[model samples]
Every structure is written in C-alpha cells, then in structure tokens.
Target: MDCILCGKCLEVCPLLRATGREELGPRAKADLSALLRGDAVALDAEDVARLAGLCLGCRRCREKCPQGVDVPALVAGLRAEHPDFRAWLWKTWLKRARELWPSSGMAAKLIPEKFQPERLAPFLKALSLLRGGPHVRPFVAVEALPDLRGETVLLFSGCTARYVRKEWRRAAEKLLEAMNAGLHKDKFECCGMGLESAGFGPDAARMREKNIRAWRRAGKPRVVTLCVSCHKGLADYADGFEDAAEAGEWAEALTPISALLLDGRYMLTENAPARVGYHRPCHATGNDLDHALLASVLGERLPTPDGRECCGFGGIMQLGAPELCSQVNERCWQSLAGSETVITGCSACAAQLTATAPEGVRVGHWLEMFDL
Candidate 1:
C-alpha cells in the first residue's frame, strides 16, 4: 500500500521543521519510497544518495505513522543501494573510533578551515566535540545506592563514553560500585547504528555480531548502557539472533543505567543550576526513564514542558548536509529557552548540543550531573 501522506510525520520531523522543506520530511520520504519501488522516478545513484541523506534517523516518523512504516529503515535501504565516500569515511571513523577519536579534536583544531573541503567540514565539527566541553559543576549527589542484586554487570559504553567522554564511563562504574555491583568491561565496537545509518549494512552486521559475541563471552551478564543510543542499538540486536530464547535473553539483559536509578534515591547539590534543562534524544522512548529520574531528583529545576526537544544530531546527515544539521541544532537550542545547562542521555545529542550551544550555555551527559 502507498503512503497515505497523512502528514503526521511532518509534524514531528526536526529536519522538516528546521529547514521548512517538505521534501526532507518523512511523508515525502515515504512517497519517494513508493515512487522508487514503482520505477516512477529515475534518480541516479548520487541523487538517491542525496535523497537518503535528508533523514535524521530519529525514528519519530515510525512512531507516528498510521501504517507503522519505518521511514528511517526505508531510507537506510535506499542508502545501501548507493554506497559513496561518506559511507566509507563513517565506516572507518566508527570502526576505528578508539584509535581515531581521542586525537580527532586535536586534528580538527590543527587544520585550517580554508584548507578543509565542504565534504570534510562536518567531520571536523564532529571532531571538535571530541575535544570536550567546558566543565559544568555537578548538581546531583547519590545519597544512597539502589538495591540491585545480580551477577557482575557489563558496561556497554558507546564510542563517546569509551573515548570522547571517558568521564561518563567512570561515573557509571562509580554508581555500579556504590551499589556493590561488580563491573565488567569488554572491547565492544560501535553500536552499528552509525554504520547502518550511513548505508554500510555488512559492517553494521559485523559490529552487532561482535558485540553479541562479547556479551556471550562475558557469560551474558546484565548489560548496562551509558548512552541512550547504545541501549537502543544493543537492544536491537535481538532481531538478529537465530534462537528465540537467546534473543529474549539478549533483550532482557540490556538495561539503560537511568532505568536502574528509578528506585534509587538522590539529592540535588548546592551547585545545581537554577535553570537546568533536559534534551530528549530522537532515539529515546516516549516515556524516558532518564528524564523521569531527573525530574524526580530535580523537581522544579528540570522543567517538563520544553525538555522534549530533539538535539538534531542526524547520524550521517552530519556529513551529507551539515548546514541542515546546524539549522536543526539551532532550532533545538532555541526550544530549550534560557537554560543555564542542558543534559542529555545520548552521546550523539550531547556532542551535537555541546558543539552548537550558544556562548555561556553548558552541555553534558546526564551522568555528569552526579558527583560520582
């Protein structure tokens, strides 16, 4: 069946709202999918690639579509048909993040803007985020640990936590140790969402396989993820497992660190920002436990009305259309109002917000709010 073109997706799409381009929205993408499948449009490989690059991979369209159409998945399939240099760059960056990320900020700094081509500009901006953010004082203090009785929990620290934001990993480990939960570390690769969005399907599969094998080798301990995207990515691995029981086990083993803190007690520190805000990740669920926990801890400081803004870090779109990504980030920050500090659960969102935030505005992971 063809897309009804109900326009529901347009209402929630950050790219469309930010750029005011109907063609960039999910409704148009769905229509484009139908046209492509029917051979109604004769788009060359580059044209197809450009069309695919318009998406943010937020999955907001999938949630609002009446037909349950996954527009991001459709776009990813389209992208897979036309591989390009951007895909190769993203694959190399994600796969070799450990070796590349730590020094990326320095590399970005050393290169002059005049020497950098437009295609390499977005990556340079991404590298700047790896350089790190201004130190924001912690606001929440762990008064006590939650009663979590289990085997040694494995930390599924994404690329950001592993390299760029090592502090997030340390904070997570501190929380786990405070709860007396033994911590296990592994050499996990990129969550593959980055590669999958960039149209490198085979590489994405290998990443998923590598992570799953690492989990299995660790004796399938309850996995705790620091970043929201990492949680979604690891949880998504269930679909690839051949055995139904194993799939269920894998799904059950995945846990967001925020979810673990729902029952734990916390107190706002004296240094808490008077106007703190939360930036909801596009990949995050409708009822985000991270926000919920923050609300419980922050009370009036964490306002509910405007915390739902998308950070607009559009995976490969960052390289494909960096200007659009910047526009969306601009709109996201505007929606945040006059927040003194903004916290997020997704590493990509944190990076984007940190890179684009106005002067004097601070951005960091929600984990950083704690004095771990």
Candidate 2:
C-alpha cells in the first residue's frame, strides 16, 4: 500500500484532533515513512526521534487510509532504527513487571504534587491510578456460571491485573471455577504490545515466542484474556506459528473473558450509578463483545455520546510527549459528558481514563463492574 495524501486519516486521528498539529497526522507520517525507507533525505537524530514518537498507535488512521498504509508500522520501523531511553524503559517495565510494577504506585505517591511538573502528568497520573482508592463498587453479581465442566481454560491476566489489580484476576478465576472449567496455571509474561509499539521489535518477538511456548505446554487449551490489548496482542501472535493448522487453532483458542460470560446469569445491583459511561478501547476490533455485554445489561444507564474515542494511552508516547498524551486523554473524557462512572475493557484505557477523568468521575474495568 502507498500513500495517496488523503485527509481521511486526519479526520479520525485523536492526536491531530486534540493538538491540531498537521505534521503529526498520518499523511505527514506516511510521507516521512517513504523518505526514511528510501534514505532519500538526510534526517538528524532529533528529527528521527521526533517523528518516531509522534504517533499514538491507535490505528484509527489505518481504518481511514484509502491506500491502506499502516502509519503505526511505519512509525515502528522508524523507531527501530534509533534505539532510545523510552524504548529501554518500556521494555524493562514490561519484561520485569513482577519486580517493578507493584512498587510503581508507592513511587508515584512519594512524589508530592507540588514537585510534579506538567510534562510528567501523564506518567504520574497512570501511577496514581494504580494507587487505587476504596470508592470503586461492583454493579453486578454473578448468580450462575455456564456448565463447561469437562473443559479446561487458561486465563491470560495482563500485567495490570497480575500486579496492580488482583481483583480482576480473582473475579475471572471464580467465574471459571463456577463453570467447573479446569483452570490451568501458567506463568505468562507481558503480551508484548508495549514492546512492539515502542520499537523494541526483537524483545517483543522473544516475549511472543515465550508466551506461545507457555500455551503449548498447557496443552493449548482455550486462553481467556481480561484485557482488550492482551487479547489483540495474543491474537496477532498467530502469525508467529509456522504450521497453518496450528496457527488457526491458536487464533481460535484465544477468547475474551466477556465472551465466555455472555451466557452466564448475573444480578444487577444498586451499586450501579444512575449515569454510567462505557469507554470502548481502540484495540477492540470487531463487534466489541465487552461493549455488547455491557449494553445488554446497562441498557439506558450507559449513555456515552462517543464511547469509541481513543483514551490516548499511546504506549511509549507517554514517555516522550506526556503533555500531548494528556491532551488526547482530555478530549476522550469530553466525549462522555454526563458519565458519572466510566468502565472500559482494556487495563491501559482504564488507567488513562481514570487518570484524566473529571473531578467527580470514576473509571474502572468492565470486570470490576461484576462481583464474581
């Protein structure tokens, strides 16, 4: 696919819409990609670094691109050429999540508000969200689970649930156990989405290979993911498998926890606020089973004017241009005008939204809405 210089990508880009920077748009990035690939023009190290971190990696531009140009992939290619601190830090965070993730909240709390500069707000806010409060309440209670007694499943609880939000993992386990689905215990690492977006291609590839091996050792049972980002990351791994049949099976084995709970019975509780909002993660590819499940239950309560707006958790972009990331997040919250409580499927989206939510607004994962 080639660039046609079409403005369609600009219209859907959350960053371009938020900051009004035409140079940061997909058309500009696509043009730069061609130059970078051909080495047609001399680009300084600063220019390479700037262009590399300009994208949000939401892939919204790809949807609007007439020539089918993948701007994020192009940006990733640019980033791969220049190894930087942002990539190193993101790689370390994902790779050493167990050792470093749990203490991040404490690290954030230690920094006083007065000392926190405006440029670091995006990163600080994310850490603060991890240092949660007691206000988050469940809106639904699991009354019954499906009878999949003879089956076994593996749960791919992402880094956030594994280290920060243990409740999500516990809820998923109870639901799986209630159905009598044998839970396979496996030590799964980061999904590699963060590393791939940050331009650490080799590291991400290694992580993917490690995860695929873990799946194989588990007898290739049905894998359930709680995070939308994790599901997309693992689903994309089907490309890594050499065998066509095994690749197809890998794709089929990956499932979202919400999809598995579509038929389970739940009792709506009074804990649900009067006006709740659902923030759809950008990685949600198709019908958005998470949104579908929430819509079936919340109905009139969940009235989001534009729920699909990108929350601006732009992977490694947060480390490079935190202010721009915060600006995009502000635009996302503006779309949900009257939402007192906001829920999302992706852990990153939940953290970003919670960080940038209005004074009285609250944000949580869709799983947190249920008491399993």
Candidate 3:
C-alpha cells in the first residue's frame, strides 16, 4: 500500500521541526518508499538507509494519516531489506561504542560527570553518554510477591524501567498495593521493539512467542506494564489474538498502569498538594487513548491547555536524534512551565525529560505523585 500522499502527518511531526528537512517528513518519506517500489529510479543504498534512520517512530504520523499507514513498519521493512546498511550506519557508527566498550552501566556511571557542552551537541553521542543508570540484565529473578490476589497481573518492566529508570517499578508496586492487586514477576524477553524497529522480523516474532509462553505459564492474569513500548506490543498481541478469534484466552490480560489506576475503585487522597503536568507518551496518545484516565486521577493537579503534548522520547528517537528530541522536549517542557513538577506514565518520557529538563523543574511518574 502506498502512503496516499496525505500531508496530515507533517502537521504534528516533531522531527520535522527539529531537522527542518521536508524530505524527512512522513508524506515525503512514504512517497519516496512507494516510488522506489514502483518503476522510479532506484535509490542509492545510503540514501535509502538514511531515509529509514530519520524516523523517530513516534507514531504521530500513524495518528494523523487518514489511510492509517504504519510508517514505522514501513521504515522497518526498508531497514530489513538492507541489513548491511543498517548495521554500518546504526549499529556500527552510532551504537557500537555503548554496545561494545564501557557497557551501559559504565556509561550511566559517567553521565553525571562527563556529559557536558562538547559531548551534548551531537545527538547519538549525547544519548550514549546519558546512560542514566546501569544496564539491567534482562530476566533476572527478583523476590516474588507474597501471595496472588484476586486477579494476577504480570508486570513487564522492559529494559529501561528494569535498569535505567528503576524508580518507576517502585511507584507502580506502591500503586498496585494500594489497589489491592497482585504482581507476578518473571523473566521475559525484551518486548522486541528494537528488533522490530531494526527490521528483524523473525527475531521479534520469536521474542513475542517467548513473552506469550511466559504469560501463559503465569496463569495469564492481567498484564500491566510501565513502558509505552511494552504496552504497544501487548496491544498488538490483543489485536492479533482477537483477529484470530482467540480473544480472552491469552495467558494474561494486558493494560497500561494508568488504566488500572483510572478504574475509580481505588481510594485517592483528598487535597493533594502537588501541581502536575502530564506528558503524554506518543504510543498512548497517538493510539488515541488521550490518557483521560490519568488526567482524571490528577484532577485539579493537572496542567492546563496542552496536556497531550509529547516529551520527545518515543522508541529510540532520542538516541538517534538527540537534538531533535531535545527540541521537541522543549515544547513539552514549555507546556509544563508553570507547574512545579511534570508527571508521565511512560518511563522513557520520564527519563528523557528528567535528564534534559530545565533546572528546578522536577520529573516524575503519575503513580509516584500519589501518597500510596
């Protein structure tokens, strides 16, 4: 399917503003891909690869497209077709240092001290430098919760929440306790977002199967996650399952933590002191959830006017496009300018905003704000 050449996507894209490159815009990119697929002149491998790399995979384009073109998927397909280009450009040049020397832990350790003016200019280097915290070894066994409550909820904390932004797990646990729910901790694969983004379809599908098996073994309670990437994967599962007439029979149900908190059954403290601005994750907002449940929970504490803006941390966008990410984040930061703190349900948004936020403005998760 072609992009249909609708310019709606350009209106809401943050990357366009940061790069000032019209060719990088969704419609242009989509048109280019379609042209290449047709009888148009074959693009040089480098140009084709660069075009794929330019996307942040924010899903904003998906949201605005009337034809509902999955631009990210298209980009991934292009990348898969040219693995050599992908490895050389993205893995070797951009991500090799972190994946090779010093490790994510060492990178995180050096961030507070070494990240400065010189290193911060180029986006990829800055991302590698801002490791935030240690690299969490995925699927490590933690102390399991005491007992299973009425319904089981498997908590998939993804890579970032497991290692980099560990605070989100604590806040989520507290909120779950307040709601009298049980959490099942198990070793699960990364949601395969990186693989999907890199066009490793078989690898991504394998990881998805692993996640499905793990959930099945865990009694398939409701699955709640802290990362938007994880939630998107789970939502994809729900869609695929339902499409195959296998609905409601999965190992566990999956939903965002914010959705659980919005059930209205949990008791909330009256007259909370903090004033918060909510940063909408592109996955959640772009999926059209609008995060109304989180907004309701925040109530009078919510920021006014533009509560649905992105904090520019979608997928691996910040890593690949740091300047653009920072530029986009500035708009999100401005929306919360008057507030004492900004709250987000997504860990990536929390981390990106926390690292680059203007001094004195605090960043936190929505559950972290509650006095649970």
Candidate 4:
C-alpha cells in the first residue's frame, strides 16, 4: 500500500524497457497480487499464473519502487496459489536439470522455446559450453595448500559451478585453501533459486531445509559460494528465518570471496597486470564488495566498462522468454564495447556473457585475476 505509484520501476525495468510490455511491470504484478489477496477477481487462476511467469526476478522493480514493495514475494504467493503446467514442469524438471546435468545445462532444453531446432540447438550448445573457456577464465586453478588455519567452512557448490563451470568451484576451493581454512563439502542440492522463481515454494523450502541441515550437520561454520544466485538464495532463507523485513537481503549478508579478502581471511599478494574490463552483475551489489575486492586483488589490471545491467540469465526468463532475455542481454554485451576480457561475479552472467560475447572479447569471473 505504500507504493507511491511513481512509475520509476517501469523506466528502468529490463523486461519492460526491452520488450515494452507494460503488463509485465511491477505495478501490474502488484495489482494482480492484490486481486489474488481479495475479490473483484479479473484473472482466473490460469491467467494469474501466466502473469507470474512473466518476470525476471531481478528485483529492479522493488529497488526502484519508492515504497520498497515486496512485489516479487507477492507474485510468488500468487504463483503458489495457482499451479500451472509450466510451473509444475519447472518445479519438477528443473531439479533434473540440476542433478542430471551436474556438468552441463542440457536441462534448459526442456523449456518450451519458439525457435527452430537449428537455432535452439546452438543456444543450448552454448549454454552447455558455459563450463568451458580457459581463454575467458579469470582465475587459474591452484593446488590445495598444505597448511591449515581456521576451522572448516561450508562451500556450497551451486549447480552452475558444479556442472557448467567447474572452475568456479575450483577457484573457490583454491582461494579458500590459500586462507588456511579447511572445507566442509556436502551432498547439497540446488540452492532453490530456480524453484523459488518457478513459484514452487514448497520444493524450494525442501532444498533450503537440506542445506540448513547440511550446515547443522557440518557444525554450521561460516558458509560461502562462488555463484551469486546460490549465495542470494541461501542468505535470503537465513534472513527470512530471522525476520520478514530482512528476508531477501541476502546479497548484504552472503559471504562472497570478496568479503573473506576484506576481512584479512584471504590475501592476494600480487596481481597480473592486464588490460581487462568487467561486467557488473545484479547480485554483486551491496557494499560494493565485489568492486573493492577486485580492485584490491587485481590492482591496476582491471579496467571494467561502464554499465552493470542484467546479463538476461534471470533464472526462468531465459527459458520461457528467450527473446526478451536476448534483448536485455544484448545491452550487457554492448556495455563490453571496447574491452578485451569482460569479468563478472555471477555464474549465470558469466555463462550468458560468454555465450554472446563479441569477437576477441572474453568474459570471465573476477577471481581469475589471482596468480595463486
């Protein structure tokens, strides 16, 4: 009810701005949520479910809203109340994608796409290739250090890192081991970002419970992840378990590799001097930990380009609305206009940017700057 209805969210919304779909904007979703909460219902359960599927979950809507309305959560409720086929499919098969393709994204093929087989094949192949690319890799893998310092920390190997780009997991491990900290590896499931996006709150909760229990079983030491989405999901769950208002403030609390460095827990003695640019991801926000930590680790080697827009890997949006995803992602690639290598912090961004990167332009993670 606090929404000033200033329409600020519409102006910068990647989906609305790119596709000009006013109905997909936050205001419309909020209105729909209100209707679901009461009477005078215009949309039936099916129509309501369609509207819920039409979001990027980028939180730009809430970020830009003056009222700071929890539109995403509201839409999530509507989605939970209405179980559509697509939601059901995502709730069911997305887990398969995570588990079966532990080293690839072959599961994205399940999404109903509008493209011909030839065109779609290459995109799926490109997604599968997200796990490859030493040319675009930011950090090199180092052997585990022998010395140990602090107690073990839980390293949540997100699906993308586990399957698509194992280097991300390797990088996280290498970096952590350098800090003299032992690792607590578990048979953890997906962090529930995809399930949450699909409105499968119960499914998402189960995954969250598994992770929470993993933490409990592992002694609940400090936790960290290389994947931004996983980090966001885990942190949000922890915060929600504490307070509603703090729920989804995950980026603010989730410990990225950057935070460890800032805390004197990890140290980068030197950096390779390279003329490289960067792609700022949505999940890398909060206290500018990514930017500051990169500067400290990379030194004068970093020359990131301007603009920090979404790479169009908004979980299900890429699968259900590829065209809109492409348009928004085109903007991100464009931002890398004059750079040699584009570095980012999120696995999804790395994958999307790498898939569509221009000739001679490589996309990588910020951790790649380390010599290790």
Candidate 5:
C-alpha cells in the first residue's frame, strides 16, 4: 500500500477541515474501509455505520490522492456492511416513482411560492427544480440545423433533471430541436448513483446493466446529459468499471450540454446579460473545457471564483452528518452570498446553495442562463 500516510488529504478534505476530526479524513477512513472490508477489523453494524457516515462521498480527496485509490468505492464496500436506515425506501421505492414524473404535470405540486427557499423543501428549492415552481426557464429554440443522417444523440435525463429539475429536461430538449439532430429517449432506469452511494452494489449493477441495454436499444446513440455525475457514471459503466476517461466514445458521448452547444451542436438564443456570479462545483476541476466555455459565455457577467469552496451536498452526508455538512457549506455560502442569482453547473451544489441562500437570492443551474 503506497498510501504514504502523509495526510495530504486532511489538508484538502472539506469534511475534515470542517469537523477537525482525523478519522473523518480520506486517508484514515479509506484505511478503515480496507480493514472492514478485509474483515481484519471486527466492527459491528453501528460501528460500520458510524465510519461510513463520516464520508461525504465528495471524492475531492480522491482527486488529490497520490496512490490514485478510489476511496468512495472502498467506502461503499464497507457501507454494505451496515447500510443507512430506510436506504431501500428512499433510494429505490420512492426515488424510482419520482423518476417517472419527469414529463408529468404532477411535478407542479412541489413548487414553492415566489421561489422562496423557506417556502420549499430542501429537495425542491433550486430554480425550476420542481418545474412546478415559478421561474422555469422558458425554452428558446435555436435555428434548426439541416437533417444530417445519423446525427442523433439520445438524452440521458438523470433523475436530478428527470424528477426534480424539470427545466433541465425542457432546456435540453430546446437544444436538441435547435441542432435539428435526431433526439430520442428510451426506457432508461436510474444511473445507479443512489444505489451505489447507498452501498447496494448488486442493485446498482443491475440498474447499470439495464441502462446499458436501453442505450443499446436506442441504437447506441451518443448520449448527452445535463448532469456531470450522470456523464461520469455512464462513462464508468461503458468502461466496465475502468477509468471512464479512458473508456473511449461511449464515455465521451456523455458530454455536458454547455460543451456540446459551444462545439456548435446547438445554437443558443441570445443572452440577456445580467450580473450573475458563477460557482465552480468541486467536480468542475475535471472538466476544464466546460469551465472555459462557461466563462466565455458569461464573459463580462462572470466574476472570479475566489473563496469558492464545496457546497457540502456530499451524497449521504446531508442526512448522516448535517452539522458537519453545514460547517462545510457555510464557507461556500459566504462566497455566493452577494449575487442575486448565483449560477452553477452542479445540481447538488445548486440544491445546497438554494437551501442556504437568503431570501430574494436564487441559485440556478448554469444551463438555465442560456434560457436556463
């Protein structure tokens, strides 16, 4: 194990920094995961749950690890020892039903009045997240492109946009129509993000296989997605669990909407320039092209992303360790407090920002700005 135990992860871990607990840092927790999974450490269910709860699943530490280990996956293996309470109900039972509501009007019932955070639940507070809420970005159609043969791209409406952020689906549709490409969707299941995060490996694997079959049936169309997590996850599946970036075209096709539009796949309507600040999601570090493209689009309106930190929506961390979540969120919240409308490319960050935002301030997906 070339871990070195040098403790660099402690320096960068948002959760560790917020909580000041060494055991919660990536290195220590990852070691714990190794031990628990190896059965070298005899831990009861509560002990295992306690260990897993400290991880936010941000993978920020993995981004910095010298050994290149995937601590989240390791933690997931350990989490399987003692899953969270009602993991089946929230991750499967209800979440599955919600995914089916993407195209339905039933989403409207969850909207908050005046787009106020206090009026909405943590799950539906972002702009047009519920799409039932006011301020859904109106679709601005692009000039229709010539119908080039075999130019179709399938839309992978991840659960974030499918169930909660209805505008994400609508906004993606407008771009597809503008590109004049063959846009299609099939009966796809969850990207298995929730299941994997919840430590249900077999269930997650099943969902991944189901999605692979759906994509194949959709004629293996290149996939374009609005969610970065989905883009990464789909790529992971295509690679057969290898590094997604090395997985070739199936992974490459999982492009973000902004990058595709900037590459001229779809022409965006004119921007009604407003002074909106941008926050770089923690994962944005991996997508440089998108960072540059977004900055280019917001040229004069965009400001420096100084003091921008993690929003602390680290998967299960919100439910497991909220005080730590708040501690981590406060720094990012302070950075975004000035903008009346703060734009970010991450759905999880958008949700966290919306929950913590003061009255009259709106946190919206960056895609929303392009009639986003």
Candidate 6:
C-alpha cells in the first residue's frame, strides 16, 4: 500500500472534522498501513483500534482521491486484522435483530417507548414531533408495472427499509409505476451493506449471490432500490469477483428511485407548500446522476446556500459514534439553517437529522412534501 499523502480524502472526511485528528484521515491511515508492512511499528493495539473505528466509511474520499485508493475497504481490512469484540457485538446483534424481526412492528418494540428527546438538543426534540415518533407499518412489496412490463427489474428491499422504513418502498413503487416499469421480487435478499460494514464479507457475499440468482431468473431487466446503501452495493457488485463483468451483467441496470422520479418526462406537479432544503445522503451525492436528479426534483424548494450538504448518518455510524454524528450534523444544520423543513431521499438521513436537529427545524421525506 503506497501513500501519496494527497489531502483529498481529508477534505470530505466527516470524522476528521469532528475529532480534529489528522491521523484518522484516509491518507494517514493508508500511510500507517504501508509503514506496518515494512517495519515493526510500536503502536499498541488500542491506538490502532481507535484509528480504524474513527472512519465513517462514507467513501467520499474514494471519489475525491486521484490515487484511486479504496479507503473504505482499507479501513475495513484494518478493523478485521485487529477485531474489537464490542464493535463486532454491536454490529452482529443489530443485524440479527433486523433479520429475525424484519418489520416496523419489531422496531416499535425494540426502540424505547418513553424515549427522552431531552437527551438531544431542544431543536431535535421539536423536530421529532413532525415525524410523530418511530412507528411500524406493514411491508408492502413493490408490484410489477402493468404496461410495457418487462420480465426483469428485480426490486431489492434491504432489511432496514424492509422493516423500519417501509414507506420509502411505497414511494418508490408509486414512482416506478408511473414510469410503466415492472419489478421482479424473486430471489432477492438484503444487499449486505451492514455485513460489509461490520467486516462480514463472506456472509454479505452469500446474500449477494442469492440476489444475483433471483435477478438471473428474470434475465435482469434493471435493478431498482429505495435505499442509497443498497444502490451503492449494487453499483459496486463487480468489484472483487473473478466473473465480475458477467455477474454485474446480471443486474443489467441499477438505479435509485430518484433517477426515475426526475426523468423530466414525468409530469410532476410543481405546486407544493413550504420552502424545502435538500439533504444529500453521502451515497447519492457521491454518484453524479442520482445527485443531480434529486436536486432537480427539489428545484426551487432546495435551499440556496449549501443545499447540497451531507446529513452525516453514514449507515450505522450514528449509533457507532454518536458524538461524531452530532458534530457532522451540526454542519448540515448550519447549511440548512433557515429552511422551514429539511428533505432527503434516504430514511437513515431523515432519522439521524431529526434526532439531532436544532430548534424549529423539521425533517421530512422529499416525496412527502410533494403530492406524488
């Protein structure tokens, strides 16, 4: 591993800004890994462990870096080399919980009933009222489109959205239906983003195979996902596989819901109330097409100054590093400072921002704002 020491990764690193520690940056970590290969570094395991844990794995650096270093993968490799039981426990338990009780009903049972919003800032507390609190609804699978219905187009609803954020699926289905596109529901599983993040690639691969076979059944018209993490996983499905190109072909195509929604052909109603601010999830913003589409959908509702800021949820990073999550959110909060409501396509972003919002700010899904 050669370290070019390009500060590109540091520019978008949420953890670096939160902790004010340069060593935690991707280039620094890459350099340390390079040194460990040549010399017997004296750094203790605890210090090494802290550095690995600090990464949010948002992959923003991967897009910015000219050296083409896979920073998230490097960090995952380091964490696997020096495994931490606590981190493993948290990740494993959460995955198991999601799998076993994969429904919003389970989330209602798991989350504390009398949760104290006071534990967060008053602004966050006020924003929580807009969402009405965590409630579970039944998961409704996306139905295949009627006209020009393709035999393919697998719909992969990852575990989190399958259970906790079912409404997003509803929104996606509505949008796709409007496009006259069909969706195949067979042979799909969770996209394994949680497993990949938790250093359980073998299991993630197994799940990926199951979904691939499902897509193959329909000859893979196109893969559509409501979750940004799942969208990224589908896009990078070919990365390490020997038959990557062939396996990736099984997807035929992969797209987020926003891409379909903002196709320009759709006659989207433009009359909506309240000024909206768009919060770009790290995954969506990192991709050019999805980012642009989401912005276009927001249109004039999008806040002028800093409408493109990240909400800083980063999958399970909010739970893993709460303080860092808060700090990163503070930047987003400031960017969306004067908006009546903040809108985002990602449920994780919505939840995290709502949890940490400052006074009088409201959090909502972009679809909810429009009559779509």
| TM-score for each candidate, following the candidate numbering | 0.93, 0.93, 0.77, 0.82, 0.81, 0.79
Per-residue C-alpha lDDT of model 5 across residues 192-214, encoded as one tens digit per residue = 77578667878778888777777
Q: Note each model's CA RMSD in angstroms.
A: 2.5, 2.7, 6.6, 4.4, 5.6, 5.6
> Against the unseen true structure, what C-alpha lDDT does each candidate score?
0.80, 0.81, 0.61, 0.67, 0.65, 0.60
RMSD of 5: 5.6
Global CA lDDT computed for model 3: 0.61
Stretches > 4 Å off in candidate 1: 105-123, 305-308
Give the range of the ten consecutive residues with the poorest summed lDDT in model 4. Answer: 264-273
Q: Which runs of model 2 end up more than 4 angstroms from their true locations?
A: 105-117, 133-135
Candidate 4 TM-score versus the reference: 0.82
TM-score between candidate 5 and the true structure? 0.81
Task: Quote model 2's TM-score.
Answer: 0.93
lDDT of 1 by residue, 1-372 (tens): 457878888888888888888989998888788878889357788888888888889888888888888898889988888777666666777877877788884444434465446755665765676456664568788888786656689988898888877888999988888888878878688889888777778888988888888888899889998888888877767455758998899888988888888888888877889988788888786668888888888889877746435677788787778888888888888888789998888888887788777889888888888987
* Candidate 2 residue 96 C-alpha distance from true site, Å: 1.6
lDDT of 2 by residue, 1-372 (tens): 799776888888889889999988889988887887788356976779777897888888876788888888888888888767666666766787787777775444434465435655677668666557333578888777678898989999999999888898998888888889899997688898888877878888888888888888899999999999899888878456769998888899998988888887777897778988888888887778998888777778877438447898888788788878878887887888888888888988887877777788878887878865
Question: How far in Å is the alpha carbon of 83 misplaced in model 4?
Answer: 4.1
User: What residue pairs clash in candidate 5, if any at all?
Assistant: 108-132, 129-164, 368-372
> Model 5 residue 200 lDDT?
84
Prediction 6 global C-alpha lDDT: 0.60
Better of 1 and 3 by lDDT: 1
Q: Write the per-residue lDDT of candidate 4 for residues 1-372, one digit (tens) a residue.
A: 555678887876777776678887888888777766677377787677777777878776766677878777777777778866556555655677556455445455465665455434434655665766534533523333334486677788687777656666787788788878878786678888778766788788888877766766776566777766667777668422445433333234346666676544234333332566777776544565677766655567666545446777766555456677788887776666776767777777777777787877767777665555
